[model samples]
Target: MAIPDGLDRIELTGLRGFGHHGVFDHERRDGQEFGVDVVLGLDLTAAGTTDDLAETVHYGELADSIHGVLVGPPVDLIETLALRMVDLCLTDARVQWASVTVHKPNAPITPTFTDVAVTIERSRR
Candidate 1:
């Protein structure tokens, strides 16, 4: 199938996660397991035709880095965490656009729930 001249796709989902970040004190202190899914859109004209790894985005490395950020130093806000994740994607050379979702399953709320999540998308101008 022929994609557009300036668009490629990479999707990663069900990546196991951990984080101690939230507005509540318990959430910050106790930490929680989260899930992340991301889809990166960028130019793959050269890589797709040439079959070169260097010319494409390294999805494995990107996932690992995002995993690191989620489990790293405790932050107080999911918004900040989301932004940090976006920043990481923007640093990659091949990723011209991306969509990110962070899911919190063990959130410290009074009521029982399945999960809480946030999603954001960005692209170079």
Candidate 2:
């Protein structure tokens, strides 16, 4: 997807983790793998000009933070997980907005689907 409007984006895709997040008791008990995608919006001017990591969002740190949220808690919905990820992205003052998608590839559903996911976007105010 294209970056929205005037903001520069830093994207992380296919971040995998195992978590106990589901409505079913068996799901929470056994846990399952989850994939996260995050798009962070901000101005890259300073970083681009100076070529300094401090002037931009450090993606390695961001990935670790996202993983922390993924493996940290047990929420019943991917929507909630997406919100948590958005919150993490917004922790950086430079990040003006964030879009998050939480993918549940192995969700317990009949008929067998490729994936199930929830997406959320939040902007700093």
Candidate 3:
């Protein structure tokens, strides 16, 4: 789904972690670096007006939470990782929607490539 209109975004990009997530045995044995980007859509009116930390989602906590997921159980697909991130983002009641991207830079591909990524968008409905 598209991000709702009139919502402000808190973007956390290039959060890195190591994970044993891949289909190949070698990949599972030797963990690799992964990058995560999250765009959280929320109404920032309260925080903007009041200048209160409680009025907004704490990005540091969110980043740590996402990193926890990244370092947690092994998964076979980046798609699954992305979905888990979306779920995490939606846990915050203030978030109206979330766009998550999981980037696998060292994907097992024959041809040289810059990166491989999976993106998922989820909304609170």
Candidate 4:
């Protein structure tokens, strides 16, 4: 992973939530709350110096994109969904490395728990 200079982090959370996506049929049908936490590594020197969105990743746009994919279709797995979210964020100009964590709060697990989640990290090629 080639990390841009001085770009340590850009964290995005809340992102509303996703109601669908999972491997089981019931999971897809029932729909659940998916929490996403993202850490974006990039070169923020330019954006910081210039104070411009063009030089950095636009979090609002990224959130919108993630929300779209989460609710759009019947994805089979959270790994796949997380990977796609990583891909979605990397489509931008400023992102050099990205780490995505998606949490399914209302998972249909037999035992009640805080939440079920999958986390993935990827760097730009």
Candidate 5:
């Protein structure tokens, strides 16, 4: 999604939440921790110049919203969860584009692995 140049970026990383999301039945029954990293593209000139809270997105509120989504519903795929988080970022008119990374650190793999994550990017069209 050709994001414009000079657009400032707001990054929120390592957001953790608990949810029941997986393909396996046992995974659904036993909840696990999920990590989210978000990058938002937006113009920060107004907020920078005016120093007004209303001029930019409130990160605290955004974090709460994302947390709610993480714990809200039981979705099987991390892809869907990532998309949901991207949607949340785009809710703000100021946000032009957003990228979300949903990390499933405790995925039910037979072999020991570090993590499994799904990332998605979306823009206002």
Candidate 6:
């Protein structure tokens, strides 16, 4: 779905963590660095006016949450990892939508490739 109109954007980029997420056994056994980028759509008017941390998402905490998801468990696909991160973004009531990108720079491939990634978007129902 498209991002809702009038929603402010809070973006976090290059969030790096170590994870064991891949389709191969060696990938799961030997963890590699992963990167994540997130974009949150929400109304920040209250936070702007009130100057209160509670009125908006605490990005540090959000980072921690994302990091936990990245490092907590092994998954077969980056798509699943992206989905989990997006779910964390929607935990806050004010978030109208979230976009997540999961990056795997060390994917096991014969050809020389810079990176592989999966991205997903979700909105509140």
Model 4 per-residue lDDT tens digits across residues 1-125: 43455667888876656566877888777887777888899877888899987888888888888888777787877888889899888887668889888887777688869978888888764
lDDT of predicted model 4: 0.79
Error of 5 at 83 (Å): 0.7
- Stretches off by above 4 angstroms in model 2 are 1-3
Could you tell me the lDDT of residue 5 within candidate 2?
A: 83
lDDT of 1 at 20: 83
lDDT per residue for candidate 1 within 3-112, as digits (tens), equals 23467788889777778888888877777888888878888788889999898888889889989988998887766777788788889877878777888877677798
Stretches off by above 4 angstroms in model 6 are: none
TM-score of each: 0.86, 0.94, 0.96, 0.86, 0.94, 0.95
Candidate 4 regions with alpha-carbon error over 4 angstroms: 1-6
lDDT of each: 0.80, 0.91, 0.94, 0.79, 0.90, 0.93
Candidate 2 lDDT over residue span 10-53, tens digit each: 99999999999999999899999999999988999999999999
Q: What TM-score number comes out for model 3?
A: 0.96
Against the true structure, what is every candidate's RMSD?
3.4, 1.5, 0.9, 2.4, 1.4, 1.2
Minimum summed lDDT over a 10-residue window in model 6 is located at: 1-10
- Model 3 regions lying over 4 Å from their true place: none
Model 3 per-residue lDDT tens digits across residues 29-56: 9999999999999999999999999999
lDDT of 4 at 77: 79
List of clashing residue pairs for candidate 6? none
- Looking at candidate 2, the ten consecutive residues that score lowest on lDDT are 1-10
Prediction-by-prediction clash tally: 0, 0, 0, 0, 0, 0
**Regions of candidate 1 where Cα sits further than 4 Å from its true position:** 1-6
